[model samples]
Target: MSRAEVKQLIGVKDVARIVLGWGAFAALLILHPLLEPPVPAPVLVIALAVIVAVILVCAFGVVTQAEALAHRLGDPYGSLVLTLSIVLIEVILISAVMLGPGEHATIARDSVMAVAMIILNLVIGLALLLGGMRHRGMAHNRTGTSAYLSMLVVLVALAFGLPALIGVDGSYATAQEIPIIILTLVLYAFFLFRQMGAQAGDFTEVDTRSPQRSPREERTGIRQVLAAHRAEVIVRLALLVVTVIPIVLLSHDMAALLDDGLGRLGAPVALAGVLIAGIVFLPESITAVRAALGGEVQRVVNLCHGALVSTVGLTIPAVLVIGIATGQTVVLAESPANLLMLGVTLLLSVTTFAAKRVTAMHGAAHLVTFAIYVVVLFS
Candidate 1:
């Protein structure tokens, strides 16, 4: 009814993202026949560029809406919403590729590994580096960070490491996959229970020495905020879902183009995974870095570590189930180089978070490790 209300409901940029994202999806559907293979190289390049651009726009739109909801929801819950929204897009993209007409047995594995490396090392590294430089040192909830890392260690080992050791090839047997799907889901469910219930405080920023709000008071405050912005929250939530649909619909087209383009270019196969990971997480990475710079170190941890946890906990099972249903052979094992990188990353993360305060020096270590990952990727 008022100017402020109108502005809060939706902005010009939000409308632009929705229109462009859907417009691109519509164009792809109509021009599908013409865009099919044996197409001209120039056309393929142009199509890929346009589609990727639109997807990026939609991704940022998702971030915008997620952040709005997050502000209303508060920490942990807010971060969870943002993390899950991004991961949903990721899972959709991976599933689209796996279901497409190709032997993409390892797309899941590649994408998951890429996500881990990018989020854990590259994004977190930059966040801490910038935050530390600006603030000298940043404080975060050690218990929360430790919980995330511990769960990550177990999930990463189960998803990427153990398969290589035990499977005849590079994946679990059909029998093994069944139980794994259940176990992974169960563990993640338990984690959700603790994270949202009894242990929720661990995931939030709190001054331990200072007095704190009672949980009931905190809940009441959050409720008041949400109630006041109910209309805005609903609008943003709807827009977030609307924006994500186009990305999901366009993923098949993108995957086909990507596979063909890479084959022609002779680029490394792993690069496809890297690109997908980058696209899905790029917005969140920016958000995390901003949080770090603002000295919201715990929020940064929630965005980065929380994201990877969901990526592994949810994605592995989704792909495994997809593999089982489609009769596709899904490979989950990492090469020796990647396995070593994972081990080092987990160890380094533990050491970094164990400290009382995170400093620029810790960030440097992470960046160096990420550099090695880049080298290994290209080499």
Candidate 2:
């Protein structure tokens, strides 16, 4: 390959990310014995920090490539790729935590709840606040946003609330688990079909009064752009997979270290869930904020709302299957307090998206709810 081809395939920063990600994974494999229990406090702390930093780097790399793919695919499909990639990371982390050496029956529940609170309340709150302050009120597609929320309400209720109401000891029976898993997957599949098919237009920004470009023109533009960058798409997709593999392989080590470190420090168990959610969503959170600030309110909505939907939709079934297969108890129900918080968050989300334009006040309301979630988490 020519130098320019090599350069396009992997930039200097991409090289750094690949090296750090895979290098960390290789080092962890070689040094696995040292990470065992009774290690020195300093060593444990250093290991945790290094693993987290590497994971973050790999995560950012994944986001960069996913964004490139999203730009190529356009709107709902592009957003789907981005959200699914992040959600894939989330599933890996959650699975690592659950399968790691611990009685973490509730890790899945805690993580899913954390993702919802973080994305719906915290991330969206900040995006709306910043975007609204600059633009007075940010406009988004009410139809698409509403569809996302409608699915979220049912899925959240089924995954979190209904389990508490019906399951014995905060978990479903084997029979119940199979049906619920199928239901969640089927619902999400149907939603994806509509979002990408007949209702695809609902996900994009459209100014009916003063149109910028016709649908045909927009389609032509996307095609031309995709054609121009076909080679880049292939390169980025390859890199995205390369970058993600390290994070997946390294996650088990990270999980072991995190469990040990947090146990030593006597931190709240839920804090692990929060950290996982934060790590998994950090890149997407930043992207959403930038999109909001750039006046792409619908893009912000797609990123934030779409992420949580994907999180709950995909993570629950995954953990449940793992639990069934491994004989681990996976908890899906939330505590009374968390359930109440989840209810409030869902209701608040409906209200926020019901409007044609979102303002700072809407953002403030969501932030207040998120603040309460944090307080509840620590207390």
Candidate 3:
């Protein structure tokens, strides 16, 4: 075939592509059990490698569609959807893994810590590094960055520290945890309504990292698009939900397999924490790299930071509610690696904000930090 034909073939698609992509992945996960000890080591390795690659490709599609939907709706709340999607995946995996009979206090702790490192190193790291490199000297609404940082500090402290302080004293069954959970949800709701809703104008935080547009009165283009394409929107929404279910189920099983695999390989339990982090972050990592390359740094910031916030703000409440309702308590306690990662993340976040520009060097630094996280996490 001609080069053009090959390119066309590469882009070729219909429901069949989606089905094959999703179905093959689903089948691998289902049949993973059948690929037993009898299978040759080399063959099993190749098969597992192929499965991971396929899953990564599917993740790309999932993230791309999510980005498309967000663009169609415009950002802010649209970004919320993308962030929540990932957070839901994390919560599902974490909850599912924890459901198995072991002390998952470390799982909760490490998952949150893993997320913190991803946000600080990968997300904020790229943002500052690339934005600084491109702009050399960029400026943002310091107030905005500071405010976000402050909220982040409080949120992290509460989410991670509170469990140790409060302890699962069975008050989880009483009204005690209720008030705390309610307060947590209320704070998130306030920010959602204030920033993305009617009060958005009151907070003018320009992301110096991104390109600027005309300060004209905002238009309702997005609203019109969403209204006109209601049916398509509904279809996409339904597809998102449909896609999520299998991923969640597969992730749950994947976590289990990962645990067994780690034991077989003599891997640290922290490896499982890292895997949970990887599964949840697979989508955001793709989007972040793309946004940075596309020169949409502000969007990148919004996505990365916004995702961090949502993971803590949104996922915390949902998981807490689940735990409360199901008579399980999901608190933050675990391996020392969790605290180590958290400290690193917090320090990086503060440095990024204080010095509002990022360079390729900075990006490189963040990547190095990420490497450290991987080493420590795996060690």
Candidate 4:
């Protein structure tokens, strides 16, 4: 094979994912005796690093491969593919960790909140800043952003706020959590029907237009386009499974390390949530940033808001169900400070996206908010 052909056949991302997954898995298994109680603090730290690295690599591989498939599918569908892929990864990883050998009542809450923070502030701010530098400012679909925010505000309240208000015990009662889960599902389902079905055009367009892709992505796109439908379907289906297993496997080890590491250092419990959020958000974060740089502010909006909404929408229900199945008490309530941050975030999203255009000033505001979130996380 020519060098180019060889490169195509031997995917660095794919191979890295496989190696990291197996390596992490094998390491964890082999070190199980050492990993038991009184485990050296250094060993725990090293385990944390290796497992998180493996999971992160697999995540990026999943995103890269999914983006290629999304390219073939096209928007609405393409965007759906991307958002759902990230949600699936989050669900798998979170579920794995939650089901593992410890209690993690707040993983879902922290992760969803982290996603909301990342989406509304960091991703949006960076996108606006980067897109402005590239194209002097970018325009987004106000209608979709407005609608998304409308649902987002309500959903955030329902998921994170409602629990604190009505719960009987320290956390929510099954009674309270179940209702919130149902409400979130119904609202999100309606939003999907409207966006993907009734008035899909109101949403922003994805800019996977050929001219924007890299030479390799372009060639892959061409191959995807020319391939028989059956072959393409088989490839995507196969790749999806291969990419996800590693993340699910590594999540437990990563969770144990985070719990151990944070506990050892006397860090705030919320820090664990931030780490979970960052890891799960990394894959989608890349695509959103790329969309912003490509001058597709609308796609960036879709990616950011879609992720925020879906993280709340899908995750709440999934977490609730997991709680029911496992007898785990899932807590969605944020601390007072975090609740304030969320309120500010939702409020700002309402006003920022109320307009049709976004600029550097908007990006700066977002970055400032993101800085506050980080500061609070550390403090």
Top-TM-score structure, candidate number: 1
How do the candidates rank by lDDT, highest first?
1, 2, 4, 3
lDDT of 1 by residue, 1-379 (tens): 4669867678899899999988998889899899777668999889988888898888778877777777778788788877887688778777877888979888788888998999889999999999999999988889989999989999999999989988858989999999999999999999988887667778888577876666666667667867787776667777887887777567545766777788788887777767766766776887788888988889989999999999899899999999999999999999999999999999999999999899988999999999999889878
lDDT of candidate 2 over 9-59, digit per residue (tens): 688899899999989988998998988887788998898788888988888
Question: For model 2, what is the C-alpha lDDT against the true structure?
Answer: 0.82
TM-score of 3: 0.78
CA lDDT, candidate 2, residue 272: 71
Report the C-alpha displacement of residue 332, candidate 4, in angstroms: 2.3
**Which 10-residue span in candidate 2 carries the lowest summed lDDT?**
211-220
TM-score per candidate, in order? 0.89, 0.87, 0.78, 0.81
What is each predicted model's overall lDDT from 0 to 1? 0.85, 0.82, 0.61, 0.74
lDDT tens readout by residue for model 3, 96-183? 6656666553455556776778776866576656666766644444444555666677777777755655656312334655776787
- Better model by lDDT: candidate 1 vs candidate 3: 1
Candidate 1's error at 167, in angstroms? 1.8
Model 1 residue pairs with clashes: none
> Total backbone clashes of model 3?
5
- The C-alpha stretches of model 4 lying farther than 4 A from their native spots are 1-16, 36-59, 92-102, 173-175, 206-230, 262-266, 322-328
